[model samples]
Target: MLKIEEIQEIIKLIDKSSINEFIYETNGTSVTVKKSADEYTIQQPAAVTAPPVIQQIEKPAEPVVQEQAPQIAAAEPATSTKKTVDYDYEIVSPMVGTLYHASSPDSDPFVQIGTKVSSNTTVCIVEAMKLFNEIEAEVDGEIVEILAEDGELVEFGQPLFRVKK
Candidate 1:
């Protein structure tokens, strides 16, 4: 088993290096470190009884390809005199993590469609590395649309809700 200091050292080394993933196993102990975007995940398993098996299979030769004829473009439609443009404000995620609509499983969501919110109102929670981060609406408006579903994995700067001021 690796000590806490050793694990921390391994994590630091992995973060500094260019490699994205590192797996080490010895004496029935296994440690796996993986990097996703700008974050690093470290997982230490209790034990490993056997080494992983990797098998390579040969691929068959590529078949002959045939080119298809190009299609003609369609006629353009007539332009309208008036155009309506949307000016909705998007609430984006601050970090890459799993999005939660509510604080707990049985609790109600912080905000929903048509819910009025201020600049500091909590709208959702983003869980990253076991830390729950409350996400707030940065503009004073009403939620017009929910872009992401509950318990979905969201990327940094991804829009979670659309609000109309």
Candidate 2:
């Protein structure tokens, strides 16, 4: 079971972060915290036993208007600006750590959009357990987009960049 101060800290972190919900489990205890606009809610089991799994709705409901179907179809091009890339190579993080786009704060980023990189290019750095390890782009290609945020914590095998040969 988590202490009251720990739970409050987690709630504060969730409020500051963009994450909608946080769930933690240990041994047989489980806790879930969700943030909605200005309200914060925390849920936990009464005893020390684990709680049942809960499915959540990830997205909000979109407004549907049958009569405006044609108008919506005509206005799609303006609202939908995202392009779909069918084939691309992803530069993935090799370890779980904090990702840094540059060696230092004022320094230029290692790679950017449209930057051409070889197989041995150092694209970024991941600091794990106080050690900063330079990450390489294993594929030779031009960087199309950066997927991970600079200085954010990244999970192992998380895609950092999208590249096209």
Candidate closest to the true structure, highest TM-score? 2
CA lDDT of each prediction against the hidden true structure: 0.75, 0.75
- Summarize candidate 2's per-residue lDDT along 61-149 as a digit string, tens digits: 43323321111111122456778764369999999999999999999999998899999999999999999999999889999989899
TM-score of each candidate structure, all chains considered together = 0.51, 0.54
Worst 10 residues of 2 by lDDT: 67-76
Model 2 regions lying over 4 Å from their true place: 1-81
Error of 1 at 107 (Å): 0.6
Model 2, residue 84: displacement in angstroms?
A: 2.0
Error of 2 at 82 (Å): 2.9
